[model samples]
Target: MTTPPRPWPGLFISFEGIDGSGKSTQARQLYESLRSGGHDPLLTREPGGSPGAEEIRALVLQGDPDRWSAETELLLFTAARRDHMERAILPALQAGRTVICDRFADSTRMYQGRGGLRDKVDALHDLMIGIDPDLTLLIDMPAEAGLARAKSRATDEERFEDFGLDLQQRMRDGFLALAAAAPARFRVIDGNRDMDSVARDVHATVLRELAPSS
Candidate 1:
């Protein structure tokens, strides 16, 4: 196995899933739960976590779907992520605060990797951003259901969603494959249930992972 990145004092947890799998909701709930328990936790999202990243996000998410090629999009995402890590994530982690992110490098692997860019994505991640979340919660569900939920959101950030259900199905498979490849770092949660039930499971999983080692 590849050597992991240097460790930080703070815990890093990331939530990932197909759009509308409720991963974002779960991430926010976890942040609130931790904060209510007296933990200093920061809740943030990808492609726009920092000021510079938000600018890049607009470039990536809005405008013509064909405005940029897949490779260009990958580069933009990487640049934004780099800014996010240096300006936001690393600072918080070094200060001993837990960080909960809505999405991370895995999204790049699944979204852009579909066009034979998987190896490139991995290489860029290793070279530019070497850190991985200590725990990753993948909210798994059927693509059709996820898409339906996503469509209901009616957000301006519809670039990815505009790809439609077929692409979503492929992305779902890719996410599962990724989780299977890194079982220790990943917890696959069934996201087809009620919000409260899913939140309970997520909270429990997080607590188990954060428990002190004997």
Candidate 2:
């Protein structure tokens, strides 16, 4: 008798942070650790995965400073995400590769929703109705600290990152709110801690999630 085809098994995890939170660093650390531990992992980022998404990312990030609006930015991000999911993320997962995304839908909800366009948050939600991360890590940090760190590293700030302090603060609050609403899926990490400590906690969190329930 012929045997049935084997199915690919995978997991999806996303990292989120306002700025200077070191989420991208930690996400890379986790991705390395997963691979070192013998897991098939795919490390990718939003707004720039597939070719289509890359084009959108260029427009979103490198646009004229005064040429963009909040709603336009949000729509661009969501469009990139939709293309990324269908072309990169979903395919990798189905092929049995654990997918790690640096930023995802939550970033839009936090940045656009709480930053200034609170009215557009629901519309953004509608854009990401079916996409959900199996795990989301929120690297929480103060707005001032994050801004400082972000500025230190970036030679020229992107439009969103260049927003006012109040906007960044509200974005941080948005992340916290989402974490509170979904304790099981969202892990809030204090970004003020040492890098080693943050990485250690991320490792522990991933292991715990991979472990079988009691």
Kindly list the per-residue Cα lDDT of model 2 for residues 56-167, writing each as its tens digit.
8878776465567778777888788888988999999798778889988888777656446755766665656466788898999898988788767854436666665777
* Displacement of the residue 111 alpha carbon in candidate 1, Å: 0.3
lDDT of 1 by residue, 51-149 (tens): 999999999988776788999999999999999999999999999888999999999999977789999999999999998899899999999999999
Go through the candidates in order and give the C-alpha RMSD of each one to the true structure.
2.5, 4.9
Q: Which stretches of candidate 2 lie over 4 Å from their true place?
A: 1-8, 115-129, 155-157
Q: How many collisions between residues are there in candidate 1?
A: 0
- Best-fitting candidate, measured by TM-score? 1
In order, the Cα lDDT scores of the candidates are: 0.91, 0.80
Clashing pairs in 1: none
